[model samples]
Target: MSRKHQWRGMMGDVAEKCGTTVAIALMEKLGGAHFVVPKTYTNRGPMAKLGRELAEPFIAEYAGQVVDIPSKLATKRPPPESRFQEVEALIDKNYTAAQVAAELGISQAYVFKIRKAAGAPKISSKVDKRQKSLFD
Candidate 1:
């Protein structure tokens, strides 16, 4: 005895019924044009050097944003010894300092200090994992 084999084609009719176009589908995929938005910064590369040169050092009366706000309140204090581990976990999870601060119920600035103290790795401002508003 012998058997015949056959293959069915794509259900383009179903796709059509779903009302999705080829261009629309591809644009919504990862690395697609629909979702990703490129960042726009004021200065970059060589301009950053020039910017630094023109930047002024913090002054006593510069009117800082968090004046008198204790940096210690940035994140939860588990213990002095566990600071590194805690900070490491947050970084590994790619959470923003603000996210860590919020999770640990503290301030974003303090979470930044923990990161500095641990020295886990470099984090990019543009690619902060937690996707938080900088002003927050």
Candidate 2:
């Protein structure tokens, strides 16, 4: 696939797993925004591309550093964006994306979107639609 196509595909897989809109998640993910837990994708191609993108900012700093040190401080580091941190904190002990939206007072669709964008699977063991609110 073309490079753009690869990024798009990787972005798609990320969108599918993290449960947030593709655009939102991709911006956070590709823009070097970090998360409490780095998301991984089932598809390798896209994942590799994203990994490279993420590493670009760090390559220069760590160019000749010891194994323990990163070449540089990643362009963005020390606590990634909080976009998904709230939701991540609400995940079940099993690391499942359960009861996040209800707890955060956000749309379940958005919750699902973020989780999927974070690399959650289609077959989440999570309880879907149970967190719905009248105001949603």
Candidate 3:
């Protein structure tokens, strides 16, 4: 299904009435919680951050109502198999854990964990071969 269709109920209404950009901002800022829309607009707080153009209509419709915002992860996470495949592909390219983490927007530790799970070869550390030994 299309990403647009995934938004349902109040979220879908917000997307339809306030534009997708505003809806997305709201989701990013207030998802996974019950947000109380103020009866009146003010110069501060979440509504103010959303700006008058978008916030006004929302307040008009949902004021005095506690609206439940969906979690960002509900829409954003890919399937685990796909994620594993992506990590495996990066490993196959000989990317280091740090590089894989940065590229995938995950932690380096997680990349290492994935490497361990996949039984991939250990990433070699960079050490200058010409460095003089302390004992020498």
Instruction: Supply the TM-score for candidate 2.
Output: 0.26
Off by over 4 Å in 3: 1-4, 77-136
Q: Where does model 1 exceed 4 Å of error?
A: 1-82, 125-136
TM-score (all chains, Cα) for each model: 0.32, 0.26, 0.46
User: 1-136 in candidate 2: lDDT tens per residue?
Assistant: 1123223333433334433333343364445433322233323433343464443333332333322211122222232234566676566433443455666665576667766667755435665545687687
For model 3 the TM-score comes to 0.46
- Ordered from best to worst lDDT, the candidate numbers read 3, 2, 1
lDDT of 1: 0.38
Candidate 2 CA-lDDT value? 0.43
The root-mean-square deviation over C-alpha atoms between each candidate and the true structure, in angstroms, is 24.4, 16.5, 10.3
lDDT of 3 at 63: 88
Residue-level lDDT for 14 in candidate 3? 75
Supply the global lDDT for candidate 3.
0.71
Q: Write the per-residue lDDT of candidate 1 for residues 84-104, one digit (tens) a residue.
A: 577558767877677778888
Off by over 4 Å in 2: 1-82, 93-98, 122-136
Q: Please report, in order, the local distance difference test score of every candidate based on alpha carbons.
A: 0.38, 0.43, 0.71
